[model samples]
Target: MVATVNEFDQTATNPGQRGPAEHQRREQILRAAGEHFRHYGYRKTTVADLAKAIGLSPAYIYKFFVSKQAIGEAVCALCLGERTGALRKIVEETASPVESIRKIYKSLALSGARLFFEDRKMHDIVTASFEERWGNLEAYNHDLIGIIRRVLIRGRELGEFERKTSLEEACRAIQHTMQSFFHPILLEQNLDHLEEDATAVANLVLRSLAP
Candidate 1:
């Protein structure tokens, strides 16, 4: 019996019943906390604020997450996870490696840029994470680079791309060229032409890798 996300009431899934239900409630709390953080900013939003949004008490929030910073890390992970997870689907589902590459870069650039643009407060969480050095930003970058490298390997396997250098070297080049599209601060400066800029850079990337 799979429980739908809508049905997991945190109150019902208490501490004593430790199982999938509890896990679902934790996800709900993270999402609620994310929304709160988006609106109120990290420094301004407290666990009590998240508790209210999740329809639970601050004490209950502790049952799932140790501290507010923990919740922030969870939220960050969820956001990056969703983006990275989609890369595989884009690569496998698309017939053309070039098209897949284009889609991946454009989706990542636009979505990430739009997210921070819409929720300006969320950027503050990123800043806080860097200042504290408690976050796994480096790991996130490495994972993303791995995904791109796999996609490139697939393209090579299909004879759609010609790699002049090693996979590591190519991945580094792509990421370096597209760094502005990935970084929040760098992206914000060129927001007025992000899609066009992303498409242009993506095309250049493909040409650089052409056989």
Candidate 2:
């Protein structure tokens, strides 16, 4: 399910009879939790550590997030929001379907390269959480496939891509290639020139899908 911005805003607000002060406090605590989780892996990070990091009691942290896993999931959701928003914007703005796909792959590679080189710990945490929460990960993959499928459908209608190619097959192929290129291990191994590798993968996929 796509999380709306309104949901994020509502989550920042208090559900009880508390005023703005409580809402602000909750937002601060969530922000602090995100930082702590990014620094320490979800399994190793404790509520007490998060509370201490934010100068709050452990009990207070529990009031905000029922458990560390919940907090980790929230953080992952927020990160996914940011990444998806950027990708969607790129897809919407690009005039060519192939260019849109190329830009999306390039953006992921650039972002992954940064995480791999500058923040290996956070990268590991995100990878672990994504693998552990395979249901959400699979949903995200399908969402990406849907986006590509829409683009392919449009391209076929416009006679830009071959009408003989099945949109579903093309979407699946693109999604598979994207996942293979975006895998953390591949990014880490090709850290020195990930953009180059991403571009090559993009070109190959575009060639296959082109009329």
Candidate 1's residue-wise lDDT over 1-211, tens digit each?
1222332233332222223443778778878988888888888888888888878997776766556786787676667667777776787788888898899889878767866777678766764654575454665677778878887898898888996678898998888887777676677777888889899999999998897
Off by over 4 Å in 1: 1-22, 52-60, 126-139
The deviation in Å at residue 19 for candidate 2 is 17
Let me know the TM-score candidate 1 reaches against the reference structure: 0.76
Residue pair clashes in candidate 2:
none
lDDT tens digits, residue span 156-201, model 2: 7766677776667778778878865566666667777678878999
User: What lDDT score goes with residue 143 in model 1?
Assistant: 74
Candidate 1 worst ten-residue window by lDDT: 10-19
